[model samples]
Target: MAIDWIGFSYAATLALGGVLGYTRKGSIVSLIAGLFFGALAGYGAYCVTCDPRDVKISLYAAFILATVMGIRYRRSRKLMPAGMIAFLSVVMILRLILSLL
Candidate 1:
């Protein structure tokens, strides 16, 4: 099987998002869920494109989505969660690296 870097990064973000969703109020959980679903949709969109194109497409989508989520979470004072930042950080960084390669 091929080592799908974008898929791995996407899956990792999802896994970490589950942990980051933890919150007593549950809103953070909801936000992470939103982010997760949004990412999933974007990733699905990326998959429909052809092979070599899919790589850059997925990475760009991933980068944009993660960046937006991070910015949104940071600006919305009420939505910031403990682990979401880390999840975004990892996903964004990985996406950038993969996009470069």
Candidate 2:
């Protein structure tokens, strides 16, 4: 099985973001959310690595993050966490979709 390096990198980025958020702002929510989603992404990557056609977990995770972060970015008009994450999520969604084609 081939490694899904991009997906793994995304998961690491997400987990790191969470850690950064906690360290910078002491936001437990950010930590939890980040780790949770990171784990989900990591697992999804594993699934994709084992079976490239199985993208359900990764797609769902990316879609959820894109929707939620997009809303947050829209409401807050901030670019750091929300906007960046939303953009990344959208990119991931696109990547996943393209892989199916």
Q: What's each prediction's TM-score?
A: 0.42, 0.98
Using lDDT as the measure, the top candidate is: 2
Off by over 4 Å in 1: 18-24, 28-35, 38-50, 73-101
Error of 1 at 19 (Å): 5.7
Query: Model 2 off-target regions past 4 Å?
Result: none
- For model 1, residues 1-101, the per-residue Cα lDDT tens digits are 33555564555555455555554445576557646755663464446333433555455555655676667766774455433643555565575466547
Q: Residue-pair clashes per candidate, as listed?
A: 0, 0
Model 2 residue 94 distance off true place after TM-score fit, in angstroms: 0.6
Per-residue lDDT over 1-101 for candidate 2, one digit per residue giving the tens place of the 0 to 100 score:
89999999999988999999999999999999999999999999999999998999998989999999999999999998999999999999999999999
Query: What's the residue-level lDDT of 26 in candidate 1?
Result: 59
Q: Point out the worst 10-residue segment of candidate 2 by lDDT.
A: 53-62
